[model samples]
Target: MLTVDNLVKSYGGAGRGRRGGGPSEPEPDTRAVAPDGSRVFAVGGVSFTVEDGELFTLLGPSGCGKTTTLRSVAGLERPDGGTIALSERVLFDSARGINIPANRRELGMVFQSYAIWPHMTVAKNVSFPLDILPSSRRPPRDEIDRRVRRMLEVTELGAYTDRSATKLSGGQQQRLALARALVIQPEVMLLDEPLSNLDAKLRESMRFELKRLQTELGLTAIYVTHDQSEALVMSSRIAVMNEGRVEQIGTPDEIYGRPATRFVAEFIGTSNFVRGTVASVRGDTVAVDTPDGRLVCSGAGAAPAVGAEVLLSIRPEAVSLARDPHPGAVNQWAGEVLNRAFMGDAVDHVVRVGAQEIRIRSHPTESVEPGTRVHLSADPARVTLVPA
Candidate 1:
């Protein structure tokens, strides 16, 4: 129930320089001119919609403008251009000069730090938002208490209601932050790396917890994070952002299985990129001649001309390994395992073929020792082509 149209935001000239470094592919970036003519473009023109009861996510590496976009919608950052609305109600419109105050937006937000009030107890923290409202807008004390208690129950913090906020564990503190946000009954919740502070195991477990909470409450939310796995596990749909622009937007399956760009292909998961040239094209099917072998891929969005340079993205899980060649399989290659890793659930094998190194993920029970000869094959449908 949220719409952002051509939303743009920028930072000061002092923040311009090398972009944030991380494990991401390099993409072109566009700069904007602030009112004072400084190089500022934290978020270029971006547009997306969050359907009702959907947990939509803006996912990317740091400095990719995911957080900037979220803050702009939260009314924390005034956009340089564009309009934002919640359920047809205008929240921001640069052309109309109608920017609402952050509090007036009626949106809930949980930051990366949790922001739990140290001196307050669990129940008090959740009730604080409702208690501070104007008399006309504020609920009665009994109503506020009811909301706070229900929010605590939804977050499974009822037993800890009297405990000081600072005394809770990291995950508990995060839930307390969420309880506080929900107590306000916001139209939409904005979460920016809400689980980043937790341990790895806690972070994984909280993904399901957060997803369950959103589904059960039927909450429409916009989540921002750099964790692809988290986005895949928790988001109803993901917007893959790069250099302040959204490279792709779709369900996790569609985004990961059919990435629109190389940045998305590389960002979402571990992919073995194979450079190739278009040998032929038949409708949506394309055949790319890589150094390793010929790869015929179906479901290609673009029809490239013959001899066009392209990159083929193949997930390790998509590559099937066997001791013997299937003889009639597509995109089959013969190689020797360069290295291997036992990943509990599966075994990862790095196979060297011709001059290319391809990663293959096989069942744990089907582990092939390093230095062993093997056959690798991937279905044409699983091989996606990225136009260079």
Candidate 2:
């Protein structure tokens, strides 16, 4: 297992540099500043762990510190604080002063760019790491060749062994990159948006392929990406990061279905948020009073105290719409359909409920005409409550 604890990285020295992502872009909220406005923290005390044979993803948007965290784990970037360890080995420790060199850390990394050596053959690319190893640690020539062949087979690139690395298709080159990383048989693999370079269709297909390779090889990997769908589809567990901190960590279903925070509910996918105050708590059910009406959450993980302010997150698909109210529905309200969008397989309708507008997603065939009166209802189990 690989563990990172309270890792911190700052740029331009503490208390001596300007803030923000420069003039080209807005400063990320995660780019924390010291109280005196001295230090610009890129990764502000980020932490997570990847179990053996599991692919844990650091998922967030640009400048959110996901890449920096991955780079720190690969020893490509030095952190200002915190501890990094691989199983029983101490890879880095600020307090103990035990920073391992990147090359000696025995971690494999695949970057956004495939970084394939254009002149080398597929086999050469895969074997280069072993070939350049220190003589004392290098495997015998036959052993190196065997490992290279085995990785190629595992990555489904055995037929491309003799092909020039640059001649392979984008997908094939991606496989070659994975083959090269796997050749080392490193303790952990760090992938930094490895699929971001491919076209959309290829990228989608490769997600499954990469997951297959990771599972079949029983590889421990930490994948970093800004794509929510990618993380949801490929990760064994996901750490949703924003502004340099982990917002929530859980299986894809939990993160998507029951987000721990408003940021998580908004970032993972689309969620309609309703600001409300907790009205009551009974057993597993917690009722909240919103501007529209009372919303009850039945699958609430931990109920907040009564009368506390909170945000109710209802997924677009979770809100059911009908021309007439379902008799005795738990959480139902009358509203006017403001507009709708046909999204191929699904349709999205925007309903104006008093002072608020709630979006509902439904089957394409269920599209409601604009300006029509509709009843918006949600199951108690589908509504999630987030602390305000």
lDDT accuracy of residue 333 in candidate 2: 88
Tens-place lDDT per residue, model 1, 138-241, is 99889998998899999999999899999999999999999999988988999999999999999999999999999999999999999999999999999998
Q: Residue-wise lDDT of candidate 2 within 1-388, one digit each (tens)?
A: 9988878788765544322332222333333455566776767777677899999999998988889889998999988778899999999998888999999999999989989999999999999999999899999999999999899998888988898898899999899998999899999999989999999999999999999998998999999999999999999999988776778889999999999888899999999889999999998899999887888999787788988999999999999999998898899989999999999999999999999899999998998999999998999999998878
| Candidate 1 weakest ten by summed lDDT | 20-29
Worst 10 residues of 2 by lDDT: 17-26
- Separately for all candidates shown, the number of backbone clashes (residues 3 or more apart, or on different chains) is 0, 3
- Residue 174 in model 1: lDDT: 94
Q: Estimate each model's TM-score.
A: 0.93, 0.93
Q: What residue pairs clash in candidate 2, if any at all?
A: 15-38, 15-39, 30-243
Q: What is the lDDT of residue 141 in candidate 2?
A: 98
Q: What is the C-alpha lDDT of each candidate?
A: 0.88, 0.88
For model 1 the local lDDT of residue 360 reads 86
